[model samples]
Target: MAATGVSANRLELLQIADAVAREKNIEKEIVIEAIEEAIQKGAKSRYGAHHDIRAKIDPKTGELALTRHVTVVEDDWRPEDELEEFNDSALVRLKDASKRDPEAFVGKEYIEELPPFEFGRVQTQMARQVVMGKVREAERERQYEEFKDRVGEIVNGTVKRVEYGNVIVDLGRGEGIMRRDQSIPREIFNIGDRIRTYIYDVRPEAKGPQVMLSRAHPGFMAKLFAQEVPEVYDGVIEIRAAARDAGSRAKMAVLSNDSSIDPVGACVGMRGSRVQAVVAELQGEKIDIIQWNNDEPTFIVNALAPAEVSKVVLDEEADRVEVVVPDEQLSLAIGRRGQNVRLASQLTGWQIDIITESQDSERRQKEFAERTQLFQDALDVDEVIAQLLVTEGFATVEDLAYVEAYEISDIEGFDEETAEELQARARDFLDRQAAEQDAKRKELGVEDGVLEVPGVTLPMAVALGEGGVKTVEDLADLATDEVRGGFEVRNGERVRVPGVLESFNLSQEDAEMLILQARVAAGWIDASELPQPEPEEAYEEGFEGEDYMAEAEQLFEGSSDAGAEAADDASDASGEEADDASAEDR
Candidate 1:
């Protein structure tokens, strides 16, 4: 540890190791090892770099030893390191060594102890840098191990400094960063000021471990409630979900396992004392504590409190909900800048659209008229007959084409002959539509093999042809995002691009299935590789959670025929729109 020549007593060496280990909060053995490595570097600089010089220090006695080892090796021995060609000082050929000692063979080592020497200025500086680097590395590792597992826990710290509006806090044992975006809006922190934050993430970076702290995280609010509410902390009441427009408004859903206890009332606390404490810490943010329910409709209704909802229509496949509210409550339901509805969407895990009753009525009527017109034109039926079919729940010509004769005949005023005539017309119309789609698909260069793939219809084949996917291999090489549609960033704004199958409203599973089947038909993968249904118990235990569509796309893209290369060059830039929420900024 000293720049002077080894003038210090042996006891001083042990003391230096113990002091450094204590100061850095590392193991004494690590500090001793660091010193040993520093000595090795210094020795290498003094002796030839090609010489195999090693240094070792005694832990109990602090006795240091330096030695040089020259090993006898095969005449053609070559270093495994590509950067190294040969070293004559550290290695000697067996034939050459045998001239001095007949017993000398490959792997035989001759060790020589070196006398103590004075430390030069350059070697001293190099040793100091090496020692400091190792110690600093150990300190960073210790800090990471201490904090990585503490994620999701609330911690209190004092602001150490601010960089670019981000607050760096001194957390007693480690440093944490509260990113500018992760802090509550308008909340300022001065150096030395105390702050409470949630440990959302801890990453070991190249420079050091970064503890990502957040004051505006939903988990922060949830943790605050646990500290204030005894029932929540004790597990009697569970905070099922939480969403926040940090420092402005928030919503939390609570569920009570006990029938006798009210989750909302308990969270509200006696005379709002518990809730008030949390709000004070959050800079006066308003919180809506709603009762959580198992039924999704009931849950959505509860999530949009203070607004009277007339009806809720849930689209399970799309994870969207259409909520109809009274005209007067529309403003209240949407809140200022759509905050209320956004929080509700986040809380319920659904995309919510709040519309007034009048709007819903108008949309229903428009849809009904469109369906009626479609039946009239496709079946060549009169308005009266089309209206009857629409009222009977027949929305498309395909519906009449596929329905059993008895079902259509059972409709009031529709006998077997009428049903038969309607079905005959529906079938004839579909046949002509299929033929037209097939002609277009062929003209677009889509192969007949594409239509033969499982789950692919003629209309889908035509859509694929338009999107630049022609052959079975081309279809198999499509990512689920490309087929299901996804959003793309353009000119700094997100824009939705429709996928080839976007109009078909295919679910994620269905889109993946289409690509998987196509891959099988294209000979890229075996049909036996397709996933099969498993029992619920077994599925839960081993849900490989594999993405067959993505795997197939990766396996075949850029590795297929010239047709696939052309398809890739001509692929559509559009994709499905991704789901999003406004309160996501929080």
Candidate 2:
């Protein structure tokens, strides 16, 4: 018998290593190394702990060897710091080495063979623990390496056990965990049930690999369709985006590489069999397969299927889309609790605001009237000219002020001379407005430093001063939302007072950026704490000019004030004259 109570043939050692490696799904070399370590530990127990002993097994022959080694040192040798790493007993002085071998020289190594020990219960138990520990560590490493790359891939497994609402699965080679939240809504799995899931994550822990599986992830739905649909699997069709409510509803956008193949039809399968298979696996979750379109408006319309979209107005600066559907289709477009539009937004990566046709028409009319009034007042133009300018997509006084002369001249009934005059008037109006606001800010005793903050316009500084935020420190002390929408008591309820940001129709992101800038300006926060600005091209179109006043003009142009109100009369008078002219022509 072997020293550790194993068979003496030594071939048994190799056989055992092979069996353990196969069972643990680890490398044969790892198992062999574990065995060598166990033998070395056993040798240490038999030999004195201070002696330098080594054990090795022949990889091919399975022959085990144990030897005690000593390094020959010169007679005048003194212990150096580097020599301290070696065991003192392992260093044999030259005088002492002469007894063993007169030919022994410094730096030479001498080895003595050690006789194998008889089997001992304590030694056998210790060796067993060491081998088992090493085997477990090796197995963990193997499991991590095997599953790490499998993330985002679909895997099938059997539910081994249910522990506190979590399902432990046997994946043939290793174990995986499908946490309760990772499962589809209201889905329950019993022990021994076969399941398919997405390998969303794989984490290596001290105990073993944590293979996190999910059926509720949107990628899981996409992967499931890939498994059931041949077109998707063969790469003829590619899923572009997917969003899921898990066990309730899901939407997948797919595009076909081959124009002859309809991606939606292929995903739906022969008589809906392919899509049904995925739905069945997801516990009867309803799925909508939409054809992908490169055109953003077309894609958004497709994403909001089963609901007719009459119009889609994209606001690129806000990353939002205003979707108008027929009055009859409003409920369907919004779905129950807005799920339809929500899923569409997720699929298209755009925030969607669904409205009925009537609502959209009314909003457009209001915007037209507002812009017409703004142009009539700011440019001192007649209602005909204001309406024509608004029709040409000039929404703000700043648009008329900063636009190239060609943009205005290109409008009907306007030429180079008229366009130049309009632009000059627009600039003069803005200068007067700025001078008035500066006078008001000074009257309110607001510090000039507050005006230097990135997003703080003259009107905003005046508003802040009136609100008791006269200094940059005061502005920095405000919460982001408070700065965006002022805090006030309204109708016995505390509410936002529609602050400068709200008045200017600025987004919450813009408001937050202004607050961060204020904090940096006040020295309350380091400049590095502020987020980096986007590249020049990424800034809102038409607002990315070198002139800072262009942004301020855009912000304050639409504000309802005495000047804007006076402009309304000009628009009304001009409208009457145009109506008279139209009647005469008819």
Least lDDT summed over 10 consecutive residues: which range in candidate 1?
Answer: 572-581
True-vs-predicted CA distance for residue 185, candidate 2, Å: 3.3
Could you give candidate 2's per-residue lDDT for residues 10-98 as a string of tens digits?
78888988888888888888888888777777777777677888877887888888788989987777767855554567888888888
Off by over 4 Å in 1: 81-85, 101-105, 378-382, 401-484, 487-497, 511-586
Q: What Cα-based lDDT does every candidate model obtain?
A: 0.88, 0.83
How many clashing pairs in candidate 1?
A: 4
Minimum summed lDDT over a 10-residue window in model 2 is located at 537-546
Candidate 2, after superposition: displacement of residue 338 in Å? 2.9
